[model samples]
Target: MFNSLQDKLDKALQNIQGRGKISEINVAETVKEIRRALVDADVNFKVAKDLTKRVQDKALGQNVLTSITPGQLMTKIVHDELVDLMGGHQEGINLSAKPSIILIAGLQGSGKTTFSGKLANFLKKKKNKNPLLVACDVYRPAAIDQLKVLGSQIGVPVYTEQENLNPVQIAEHAIEHAKQNQQDVIIIDTAGRLAIDEQMMNEIRNVHQFVKPSETLFVVDSMTGQDAVNTAKSFNDVLDYNGVVLTKLDGDTRGGAALTIRTVVEKPIKFISTGEKMDTLEIFYPERMADRILGMGDVVSLVEKAQEQFDEEEAKKLHKKIAKNEFGFDDFLKQIQQIKKMGNMKDLLGMLPGVGKAIKDVDINDDAFKHIEAIIQSMTPEERRKPSLINISRKQRIAKGAGRKLEDINALMKQFEQMGKMMKMMQGPQGKQLMNMMSKGMPGMGGGFPGMGK
Candidate 1:
């Protein structure tokens, strides 16, 4: 993430935050710091300068309201500028054609193959499109295999021609196959070279001309910093891509490409790929990204992720069980599974307003719930439904089966009991009041999840 840039921006904004009013001197100082922060993040110097200049102009011209501090005004100006620097709004893929073709292009090792799989998965799951993954990388045999593996993982059909060395022909054949199979979307994964070259460019250009894709995306590794933006510019000059895709955003990246690629290449960033997971692709939202960069977090995206995993009937059933005091280990396990489906635990926590900065140094393991899950799985069906039936002997057996210590089981039981009691309280008349108090005080609780001791 842009943790480093976020820290720098925070410190920069602090200069004008407590001031009584916005002044030319303070604005200049803050804008200078902001420029330096962008440069440090490896943003193109010209783009950085132009953006900060706009921010400074807006900051000085704005009238700080009685309710708003100088820092607040300045931050708003910068946020808006950043949003405009990226695309101001989200740009979706164009899939209106009967069989919309999306051509994926990028440098070698830029996660093009992986993103093609992810895009296919996203289209199948979210857009309700029957997508066919066409492996057009005739130069790399391994790429075709990788596409096949990913296609299998996502349950999408991958079209590959091991004997065919012409990508344009492969793509043309895949389209006919898609039409016959009733697939509505075709994502052709084109080949890439280590760096820009004439032969690679000619091959991809020929494929692009033959496919006439509804959308062409240029994928780049976000961790490459300024170099990523440069590569994007080179590609855009030739292909004039419809949009850009930033991959490997979860890496220890300075986030230069995400911040400046649109400005340099004049293309909207349509998608961002965080991890290798097929479900980890996100439609790019410039506003939410600005919020995250400013350490404001992305609550809307967090809620969207939660809603994707939410089942209305399941919730009603769980609520009924909790009201009857029947919530047990099985229900708890199901809740944990839903949370796991929401993506990485640390990333989910980072979506909270202030939690990202607070836990920047704290390692929140993705497997934080594994021990709890193991202990629950070790219980018998009856024990899972009625934990009260677990006597001391049963506890020892369950702990041994889970390869955990007896103390771990005891701690989990205590936490479960507390959670049950809390749920019961939530069902009562004073539930809202209790929740308010808990929201204010839970930060001081000084404990991790059940079985994860402080």
Candidate 2:
């Protein structure tokens, strides 16, 4: 997610580690480094200079109090400046009007269709609005099918007119259909070109005029770096979009678009698409993103993801089983399934503040739990309930049945045991103390283990 930029910024701040006070000479050196880091991240040169100047001025103005060190002060100033650069506050989609219309515009393969599905799912679940996805990409028949598949996966209805080639007419009819069906929101996914063209812009503009959308979102691939910012500006010039959606943030994006899009286009980043899955869409938060870029970890977002997946009834049942010391392979398998439902593992891990950089080089398969799931599914209900009763012969049989080796089964058992022990410890009085210590020692673990503290 911006690991390279984060490393550069961290190194830049480290240059003032031993400084006793914020002097003009030292501040200038640090500011220069900061500006260089932003430029390396693909930020617009002028934006980077303006931001660093503001940070420098803020640092120089601060009184040298014993409450914080120079390095800490500089980090704080830069954090605030980064937040301000990306929009100091969170901006939400406008759903004020009845049958609120949201028009999505972007270049082809920029993830516009996927983002439309994600946004519809987001509004349906988080905003409690009934959303109808309209397939207006008449040029590609596959585009309509893609939206339909996504709509089915998210349990959202998709409206498409296969016979009508005019997108404007399709959108107009979809809105009317929404009104009759009591759909609170209508998201129109229009066609796109490999590059920006007059015909594409005109088509989207015509739809925008006919729908008069409450919000028009410009989706851009962050992996494209500065080009993303420029495309955003062009789209904003044409459609006057209400917000921007930065997709493929989970990729090796240098953080250029995120830092400069708002400055260039004057539109807040409303959402970020971390993965190809529909559940991977997240509302953009400036402060959280700044924290992530600084390698400080985003605990707030981690907790929110946990809360969204937490079911009170399921929690109570699990608690009862744990209290009885009956937590076994079945429960563990169920837990894995629940986590898989949350989203892709790498994407979820990247949302954790420090884990993004740490795992940047590590190969984490999205199907890391495949073998574990297969082993569990091979077991009988009795075996799942009482894993301890399985002898060496049973182990070999289970391994063979799952098409895995005996060592694989043994390794899974070890991990399962460790997890059980940790859960037990978390349920103890000293758990909070231990958790606090671990949070400070290994921030990455804090992200993976949610709902254990607080």
Could you say which candidate leads in TM-score? 1
Q: Give the alpha carbon lDDT tens digit for every residue of 1-454 in model 1.
A: 7889989998898877967766688779889999999999999899999999988777766764333667777888899998999989999889999899999999999999999999999999888889999999888889999999999999999999999998988998999999999999999999999999999888888998888999999999999988888899888878988999999988999988899998888899999999988889999999999999998889899999999899999999999999989999999999999999999988887887777777777888999899999999999999999999999999999999999999999999998999999898888879988778767876676423343224
Count of residue pairs whose backbone atoms collide, per candidate: 0, 2
TM-score of each: 0.93, 0.90
TM-score of 2: 0.90
Per-candidate Cα RMSD to the true structure, in Å, reads 2.9, 3.8
Reference-based lDDT, residue 70, model 2: 78
Considering only N, C-alpha and C atoms within 3 Å, which residue pairs clash in candidate 2? 297-353, 298-353
Q: What tens digits encode model 2's per-residue C-alpha lDDT throughout 1-454?
A: 8878988998898888667765688779989999999999999999999999888778878853333677888899899999999999999878899979899999999999999999999998999999999999999899999999999999999999989999999998898899999999999999988998889889888888988999999899999999989988888888898999999988888999999999999999999998887888999999999998987778788888888988999899988887677899988988888888877676567767657766766677879889899999988899999878777898899999999999998988887888888787777778888878886786545444432222
